[model samples]
Target: MNLPNQLTEREPIDPKLAVGSSLPNPKGLLAIVLALYLVNEEKDHLDYSDKSGNTIILKPSLITSLKAFFNGITGYNATEIDSLASANPLVEMQIEPLQVPLQLFWKIAKINILGTDSSSGERTGGVRFPKELFFTTNMDILKNVISNENGDITNTGKELIYSWLTNNNTPTSSVNIEQKLTKTLSVFSEETLFKTWNNSTEIIFQQEGIYNAFDTTNATVDIGGTKEIKGTLRNLKSSISKDIHPYLKISSSNVELKNPSLATQFDNYQKRVSNYLDLNPKSIEIKIVETEEEINVDDVTILNKIYYGAPGTGKSHKVNELLKGKEERTERVTFHPEYDYASFIGGFKPITEVDAESGKEEIKYKFVPQTFTNIYVDAWNNKDNEYYLVIEEINRGNCAEIFGDIFQLLDRNSDYSITPSNELKQYLVKELTSVDGIKGIENGKMKLPSNLNILATMNTSDQSLFPMDSAFKRRWDWEYIPINYEKSEENPSSHYQVVVSDSISFSWLEFIEKVNTIIKENPNLGMDKCIGNYFIKAKDNSITLEEFINKAIFYLWNDVFKDEDDHIFEENTFYEDFFPIATKGKEKVLKILEKIGLNTPEKED
Candidate 1:
């Protein structure tokens, strides 16, 4: 703190002074020279130093803890230097084109593409393929193709592409994804990969030399001895997905206007047209039925490729049955009001990271395969099987938002290729995708099992309603399944079935007829809301006869007489369905029934 008047300063190493070096004289001058020397020290010396030996005089501002960085005690923001590094996008993968021996080979192994030996296996039809074709014993060569008589492997690529087929997540990412053989035995890799067969057995990719096979360009490149390539047209799974987009599904609309007297008086032409639904004034088809005269369903997968309808009517249940063991796959997803894209795809979720000390807030990336996503993935590369995705209550939420980039994927009629959603692109490179090089979904086509059929179910009665856009409307086959009232030898008794506590109960066919009459007389009341589920809850939970009436009355209060009731009759009338408890659990329903009245009959003896 002393001024130039009288003060002493210590110098760590005194530099040789010029004959007239006046800085060596006064203490203030000595401080100046020492400060300059310390500040100009080499960078390595700055890393560690003995500051206690000498005080390097610096500006008082530099001594302030926050500003000490300027003094170089803590190194300068040297990390900024990284900004000068060069960025090169070209990626390279190295393959040492080695010639390996045909150490092992097999023939005509009877196998099924479905990967099963069960009764279902018989359905795919047994195909003979080369089997146990191993590069070595530990390495099991996956048999995926057949060989023809003319010294050529079938397009199936079964002769050579060993573990890569059956073992997924291999060739992990596309980058320079080349395989190397450390212990090159009889040239098992090189011979099949480079020579002998020429283009006859393996596809000679146009890509010359080593390059990132994961790149979009190489996605179509067929590898040596591999029966299948990612992007090629011959790929069955991708093709099937391309074909089924435009099929219309119609099963849930009642075209009849229910005017019996008017029907009786109408001309034959009028009755025929009304039955066709196009002539019905209030008819709305949930799934399109290919009537005698109407637009055929679009044949594109991205065209309204999905259809969701009522529960017990067996919308999903029916679609699954249609495909049943007939198709290769049947995938299902239940869409609630809360279903989200994150649950469908991949996302960052909260997690705990523990170390030697304790846990800390961390993010764990989770790849959540949505019901549709998994189906699409499994179906994408396989050509031999049909895949189905059943979205229960497909429209309960905003499909446009929830589907993100894949909304286009559901377009059954649009062009199938497209850019992936922004979210999927942000987290990964194209190498991560299952199909060829599908960086995104575009043109309404999901890069999936070309055979994928989407069947979505939307209970027309759900409260979380949405008005489907006109464009989306035309893309589907909206079928309405109205109740079949007459039950005889041909129509046979259509009983009302219910599931209660694991046990099932059925009422007479007449019960459905009575309810059908009520719904017919009152168009505002939907059969899905008033009939099926009503009986389900009643018969399943064992509600008494009075309890059934009380529950049915509450059900009517929902949309049946929702807005019509007055406030004075609110408690007793049970309109608006209580707003909250229309979709309540058993507990809330018990409470509502207790307060108002009972569905149970009086127990007077």
Candidate 2:
């Protein structure tokens, strides 16, 4: 057999003649049986490395057949070969008994199946079979069989073995080999064969003859002969009982079962101890630790939420603050008046590409994913982590038109799904088929993963631009962001001062409080048109004369008090009067501040 380049070779085995009744390890016996079948068929070699780095050479065809056999028993379609092979930790534990059987095959059966080196010691390892030992139907039967954790053959193993032996065409010469295998299979039984084999091993025989004492009726089995140990059985039973029933009382010397029906289970536990002693034959310690629960994404009651407030009230800032450290897990999009479903979700976009074979520039239209699709796929692929899809200025665009049929997914009470278009379905199927928990993506329907959260911001002032209907509005949990007027660290804008000149300045928060009171009193201009504390940001804690007139004065004149008869501005005063170039621009702004009950300080000398 020629091993693959990734495998490492081990030292040559020292060939020894057959001694007493040393049975082959169950997993190793299964490997050799499969190897014999493949050798008869002249298949190419397959190589695998044990945990100790020793290379085990077999046939590549074994992977496909073994995968099918395992899938039949497990009832799951295992796509990767490694999932069924020893590379998986669980599978490795199941088939680890191959170690002792390899040595036994060489010693007892005179098989040189273990790899060897060339004359120059180049380590060219391969499998060599004797001419007399050819493959048979019995070999195929043993290849597909499975064994229990105790190394005993299962019912499936027994059925396969019986079918192999009952065949009429079985050669008479093969009966001798099959009989030897039957004897080897008996060695896995804990009751009769193990006790007989235990007598030959010196170390196991001396352990108070405990193997013989293990019966269903026995209340106590001695571990230490003539030695009084403190809490020995209590500690031993405590560790093993975690796997067994808890209906047992632990004394200093013995573990007494509360019920008589548990005797068989206790007897099996004793057999496991005997098996461990037979393998170890030396002093060993065992310790058990409790494993911690796995971490998962935090649950939220509101899956879809929208923060609504006036402009410059930190609605977007609140969303960003909640997702402060998790920038990588979040996808952000800003909605506009022209925003459509294709732009928010996904659509086919034209791409200019150069053909590799023809060497010509070609234009192709491909389905391209936008913010929604990008975050949706990411959330499904990584279900253990939380993902965010943040939409800024959500009310600026038509909600019903932009969300389209995807609005059905907002109700996460159940696994709400929507059938995507043909283009999106094909793209999603290609990306999501390999992932485990994600379903319906391969079929045309799609749902948001539980870990995905959609958060949006809406300005109450712009809510009338593309008014959302009651159906769409009720789907989202609405939160209102109120303006803070108190001067504090969080409300930095409260300390800002609007400067009309060197001496003529007033507190920005005080000005907002007075103007907001008037705006609230008016029926047309309510809280929606009220000036926000942070409507205009200040430079170095001071709102310059130019900044104040450009932002605050502009908004109030045009938006808030544009058509109101009871306005703050002087009679017939145009918006251009707030400009510096105007003759009475500065004087007009001062009179309006005083009228709004804001203090206008005298100019400095």
TM-score of every candidate relative to the true structure = 0.40, 0.52
Whole-structure CA lDDT of model 1 = 0.33
Candidate 2 global CA lDDT score: 0.55
Q: What lDDT tens digits, residue by residue, belong to model 2 across residues 53-145?
A: 332322345555545443442223445443334332112321211212322221222222225311111111121221122233334334333
For candidate 2, the per-residue lDDT at 409 reads: 88
Poorly placed runs, candidate 1 (over 4 Å): 1-312, 326-328, 350-369, 426-449, 488-508, 523-530, 533-553, 562-605
**Cα error, candidate 1, residue 573 (Å):** 6.8
Q: Which model scores highest in TM-score? A: 2
lDDT of 1 at 488: 45
Q: Mark the regions of model 2 whose C-alpha exceeds 4 Å error after superposition.
A: 1-302, 433-437, 440-442, 581-584
**Candidate 2 residue-wise lDDT at 212:** 55
